[model samples]
Target: MSAPARRILLVKTALDGHWRGLSVVARALRDAGFHVIMGGMITGPEIVRAAIDEDVDLVGLNVGGHAAVVERIIAELRAARPELPIFAGGVLPPSTCRRLAELGVETYPPGSSLEQIVEAAQRLTGVEAGKA
Candidate 1:
């Protein structure tokens, strides 16, 4: 039998309400044959709850604020699910990207391609094309 589709949870870390980037990324992930859950602007607790409730295999964060805030959310997620893989993308400056990188969360800043993001998702989730 075929394996079930790998599920991804995409969330906005801040109340930015910017959907364009997330929309494009979601579409790409969907097209790549992953089940993506769009968790619109939510707090760290909400993100944690959704991550657990949805039983996602990977988490994609759309960051639009200080790196410290994202750090906290990442911490919360790690505490809840130590093995869950997490990645992020947004208007992150070089310094902020480095900060997230230090925390082990891959960052895809502006100008990152949808193909690249999709590849990261596959790698992070261990769901290669035609195999998920």
Candidate 2:
């Protein structure tokens, strides 16, 4: 059998239970043949632990809270896994998106097409789509 696709850890950094954004993104990633681990409504610590424990190659954070909250999570993730690539999506405003981009965290706001997200996952994971 072929090896499993690269793993991606999908998480929500807020108390928000609205999974629409996460769901869509997760589906896109899966369709692109990624093994996505869903960490629902978790804290920053939880996110870090899951990423390490799962040995994920990429992290996709669904940011629903204030930028500061997501920033903390991003910081902790970076500190824990310096090489891990992180991408975020959700109700993030343009300013927040710019800040995230500055921190090297790619941000995908609402209405972002699934194709774009899948392409990014492939690039971030360094896994060719067809190989997955």
Candidate 3:
């Protein structure tokens, strides 16, 4: 029998009110067979609560700015789900990306291809590249 689809929670930690990037990424992950939970432009506490409630396999942060915000969200998620995998994308500067990497969350800044993002999801979630 096939395995159940991995659940991924995608959240925007930035308050910028942008949804295009996260929406597109959600579509890609869903097409790649992930069960995506979209948490739009929420705060740190909300992100943590949703992550816990969803029982997500991975947390994808859509950061528009303020690495500290994303950082705090990462910490909260880790505290709640220590072994859960997390990834981030959207307009991350090199230093912010480096900082997130230091925290063990993969960052996909601009110029990142959809294929690469899909591959990261597969790698982080331990799902085969071509499978759900």
Candidate 4:
């Protein structure tokens, strides 16, 4: 049998209520054999708790311009699980992307292909594509 799929937790850092892109990305990850857990909209503490509770290998933050919220979530997640890899998607400003890059998180701004996101997930989780 194939190995258990790597778990990825996805959350919205703000109440943007934009689910279209997140849904597509989730589907792509699932199709690529990664087990995806949708956390909806949550706070930094809630995200930290969920990440630990779910035992996810990677975390995806959806922050549509809420740079501060995203930063806080990243900080909390890093504190609790310092080695857990993280990537982000949504309407991120160039500045926000740079900040996230500095923190070692990958950022996919608007127009990033689903393929790119999936590849990043695999890279972060250390799972090969279609073998996650």
Candidate 5:
């Protein structure tokens, strides 16, 4: 029997309505054969709830706010699902990326390649790139 599909939840931490980046990443992940759930512009609690309810294998955050805000969301997600792998991408500064890395989230700032993002998703979700 074939293995079940891996699921990933994509969320925007800030209230920003820009969807171009998120859309592209989601499409790449979906094309890689993983189930991608887009959680648009939600709060930390909502993200945690959605992750738990959706039973997602990984969480991807589009961080467009201060590092502290993203940190808080990370904390919430960790509290709810400690083993859930989390990655982020957006307008992150060097310092913010460092902070998130310290918290164990892989950050993909502007100019990060789609291949790299896909590879990270594979690693994070424990699925082979094309097999997912």
Candidate 6:
């Protein structure tokens, strides 16, 4: 039997209700053999709790807020699970992307292709594409 798909937690870090970017990335990760858990518009504490409860291999944050909020979530996640791989995508400015990059969270801005994102998931989660 084939191995199980890697699990990914997809969360939005703000009250903003935009779902297009998250939806696309979640779909891409799923197509790449990741079982993505959608966490819509959650707070830092909520994200942390869900991350622990889900037992996912990767955490994908859909950030559409001030970098401070996103940073807080990153910090909390790091504190809770230092080894968990994280990547973010959304309406991020260049400066915000740089900030997140400094925190070891890969940022994918608007217009990032699904193929590239899927490839990134494989690299981040250590799950080879098309093997399962």
Could you say which candidate leads in lDDT? 5
Candidate number with greatest TM-score: 5
Per-residue alpha-carbon lDDT of candidate 6 for residues 1-132, written as tens digits (9 for 90 to 100): 777888889998889997877887888777767898998888899999999999988899888889999999999999999999999889899999999999988988988888888888888988677641
Runs of candidate 6 exceeding 4 Å displacement: none
Candidate 5 TM-score, C-alpha based = 0.98
Write model 2 residue lDDT over 1-132, tens digit each, in one string.
977799999998889899977888888788778998998988999999999999999999988889999999989998999999999999899999999999999988988888888888899988776554
Question: Tens digit of lDDT per residue, candidate 1, span 47-85?
Answer: 999999999999999998888899999999999999999
Tens digits of per-residue lDDT for model 4, 5-111: 89999999888898999999999999999889999988899999999999999999988756887888899998999999999999899999999999899999999
User: Please, what are the lDDT tens digits per residue for candidate 3 over residues 18-119?
Assistant: 788888889999999999998887888888889889889998998888888888888888888899999999989999999999999999998898999999
Give, for candidate 3, the lowest lDDT window spanning 10 residues: 12-21
lDDT-wise, the better of 2 and 5 is: 5
Compared with the true structure, model 4 gives a TM-score of 0.96
lDDT of each: 0.91, 0.90, 0.89, 0.91, 0.93, 0.87
**Candidate 2, TM-score vs. the true structure?**
0.95
Model 2 off-target regions past 4 Å? none
For every model shown, the clashing-pair count is 0, 0, 0, 0, 0, 0
Ranking by lDDT: 5, 1, 4, 2, 3, 6
| Quality of model 4 by C-alpha lDDT | 0.91
List where candidate 4 sits over 4 angstroms from the true fold. none
**Model 5: how far is 21 from its true place, Å?**
0.6
Q: Cα RMSD (Å) per model?
A: 0.9, 1.1, 0.9, 0.9, 0.7, 1.1
TM-score of each: 0.96, 0.95, 0.96, 0.96, 0.98, 0.95
CA displacement after TM-score superposition, residue 129 of candidate 1 (Å): 2.9
Candidate 1 versus truth, CA RMSD in Å, comes to 0.9
